[model samples]
Target: MAVDPRGVDLKRLLAEDSGEPLVMLNLLRFAEGGAESYREYARRLSETFLPRYGGEVLYAGTGSTVLVAEDGQSWDAVIIVRYPDRTAFSRMVADPEYQEVTRLRTAALAEAVLQATTPWS
Candidate 1:
């Protein structure tokens, strides 16, 4: 099952991000046990994507519990990447190299949700 860990309104959360002028952003709750390859994915993300576009990433955290207590932590990581805007984000998603890591990105996620947000305040 997917977990809802949000405690803040992301649109509001990003109100001050004028750096890249994020158009669309994705929130990822990577499944537990991806520790082995997380670094590799990060490397790919940094080298292959961030620079290609104009943006930065704000990683949330790693929770220490699961959906059900005693089940233990299920999320390997939590990430939020802000792109230059909707078009840049879309272009990044359609990039060939990103397509290659789609599987690994899938394998690492128990489930995730992406959102389109703008400043609320």
Candidate 2:
């Protein structure tokens, strides 16, 4: 489970850019005592990095009462973030300061799914 993006991942994301706003869906499964750590990471992201990189968190919430899913498919949390473009997202991940902050997220997640989405036309 990858909690952080690698250089090649960023490169690939940029390569697939369509010059449109991108929405990223995050499904997180936390490690032991990881919720607090993730909260700290989220704090830094909302306060500094998101603003610096032109990104906004559209939704963030803890998962509960799974209506439909296979066993072990439940997530501890979910987040939706929108970025002006793929370039902005990649740049944020590449930022030296953001890289430091991202460590918290890495330590907080046992498994994660970060998927980019596009609006239906």
Candidate 3:
């Protein structure tokens, strides 16, 4: 139900920083008519905010049939985005302009999982 990260969540993310690039794994379940709205959010993110914050979309795709997952665990979409670091991601979310368009993302999702990933050695 929580689409956006909270202040405490941000603090925890920063505290765990390893000074390496972070890849965010986003699992999304769209509400009715949410896909279109999410598309607009993606457009703004790819065109403006991502560049400003040194972030980029590594992959974005609609979810298909789940080969392996518990019942009611399938997602509507999956996206991977890379940020220079946790601080950059935190700053982007804090940006005034980015905040304006965040509603689109929030309104579009019934549920979401935003997880930060570290590369394997």
Say which candidate scores most in TM-score.
3
The candidates, ranked best first by lDDT, are 3, 2, 1
| Model 2: worst 10 consecutive residues (lDDT sum) | 1-10
Question: TM-scores for all candidates?
Answer: 0.62, 0.96, 0.98
Q: How many clashes (backbone N, Cα, C below 3 Å) per candidate?
A: 1, 0, 0
What C-alpha lDDT values do all the predictions have?
Answer: 0.60, 0.94, 0.96
2 or 3: which has the higher lDDT? 3
TM-score-superior candidate, 1 or 2: 2
lDDT tens readout by residue for model 3, 3-121: 88999999999999999999999999999999999999999999999999999999999999899999989999999999999999999999999999999999999999999998899
Give per-residue CA lDDT, model 2, range 4-117, as digits (tens): 777788788898999999999999999999999999999999999999989999999999999999999999999999999999998888889998999999999999999999
Positional deviation of residue 17's Cα in model 3 after best superposition, in angstroms? 0.6
**Cα deviation of 14 in candidate 1 (Å)?**
18
Clashing pairs in 3: none
**What value does the lDDT take at residue 64 in candidate 1?**
55
Ranking by TM-score: 3, 2, 1
lDDT of 1 by residue, 2-118 (tens): 423233544443444454466444445556775545556667877878889765776646655565755443544556777776556556666788767655666666666556667
Error of model 2, residue 6, in angstroms: 2.1
Q: How far off is residue 71 in model 3, in Å?
A: 1.3
